[model samples]
Target: MLILGGTGDATVLAVRASEIPGVDVITALAGRTRQPTVLSENTRIGGFGGVAGLTNYLREQQIDLLIDATHPFAAQISFNAAAAAATTGILHLMLIRPAWNPTTGDRWIDVESNQAAATVLPGLAQRIFLTIGRQELAPFAHLQAPSLDTRNKSLLASQAIDLWFLIRMIDPPPPDVAIPPGKILLARGPFSLEEERSLLQQYEIGAIVSKNSGGDATYAKIRAARELMIPVVMIQRPSVPSGEQVETLETAVAWIRKQLAIRA
Candidate 1:
């Protein structure tokens, strides 16, 4: 079995699936980070080109099952995985976690893309807490204080928006990339509620911009934002290729067992 993995769910699935008797599990990462958490000794890092390269890898490795456990926003790779599985005629599964939804007292403005989020920021708040990872910083790069000559605009547009962003990411983006105008906070997830609240308070964050990736690892920020009454600009997940998907780890395990049984 080959697991396209990078998220926490992917890591857990890799470890659990490897423990199944008589099964060989290999996890592949996109190699976006300098030191990604090693899944096991059989892990391979880097891309598999595209659909063709992935199809070749599946054939050469004699992989019977292909599991996509990538991040919810990793749409392109998910589509590639689906295509490669179709070409190679292998059992494929997508382990997609549910997206987060707004609840009571949560000020959520759902947007379609990062570009939309950037467009709405001027109307939302001045100090923004940007929690989207390092890859998609280009959309927010042009955010800056508006010039004084634009007095004809409405209050939301004429507020002299000194756009300050608190950009948080696990790793710093490539140096050549143009990031938004603000301080970058380098950190990882599973943050405590207190830590998230303190960070928000310390930075005086009036609004937050996040992807609805939906998992407990980073949900603390959402909880903190609710308590602080801070508005959130939530970017919805991008569409992925349709496929047989299971939400929980147990179901994925059961499907694997059934496939292995058929092979046996």
Candidate 2:
């Protein structure tokens, strides 16, 4: 089995799935982070080009099953995995975690893309906490703060008040990457609620921009935002490939076992 993995759920799934007696789990990471947590000795890093490359890999590896447990926002890879699995005549499963929903006290403004999030940000707040991943920061880089002119007609210009981004990611982005004006915090989660609250309070964060990459690992920020009453400019997840997808780790493992049993 080839597991398209990068998210924490993928790691957990790899470990659980490998325990199935006859299953051989090979987890693949995209190598986005400087130092990704090693899943196992069978883990492979880097991309497989695209659909063609991945299809070729599936054929060469003799993989009977392909499981995509990548980040929710990894639309391209998910689509590629689906296409490759179909081309190779292999069973494919998407172990995508469910997206987060707004609850009581949550102030979430849903947007289709990061660019849409950027468009709505100025009206929301000045000091922004950007929980979106490092790779997705380009849209917010040129965000200009609202300015008050003599006539009070807000003008959009780079010279206007600055729009600050508190960019947080597991690893620092490459030197060449263009990020918004802000401080970069390199850390991994599940961050504790206390820590999340402190970080938001410390920065006096007025708004948070986050991808709806659902899971408990980073949900503390959302919870903290709710408590603090800070609005979150939530970027809705991209369209995933149409196929069989299970939301829980248990269900995925069960499906793998069932498939193996049927084959046996």
Query: TM-score per candidate, in order?
Result: 0.94, 0.94
Candidate 2: RMSD to truth: 2.4
Model 2 lDDT on a 0 to 1 scale? 0.90
Alpha-carbon deviation at 26 in model 1, angstroms:
0.6
Writing each residue's lDDT as its tens digit, candidate 1 over 1-264 gives 999999999999999999999889999999998889888779999999999999999999999999999999989999999999999899999999889989999999999999999999876777899999898899898775553444664354354556899999989899878888899999988899999999999999989999999989999999999999999999999998988999888999999999999989
Residue-level lDDT for 264 in candidate 1 = 92
Off by over 4 Å in 2: 147-159
Superposed by TM-score, candidate 2 places the C-alpha of residue 197 at a distance from the truth, in angstroms, of: 0.6
Best by lDDT: 1
Range of the 10 consecutive residues with the lowest summed lDDT in candidate 2: 150-159
lDDT of 2 by residue, 79-144 (tens): 999998888889999998999999999999999998899999877888999988788788888777
Candidate 1, poorest ten consecutive residues by summed lDDT:
148-157
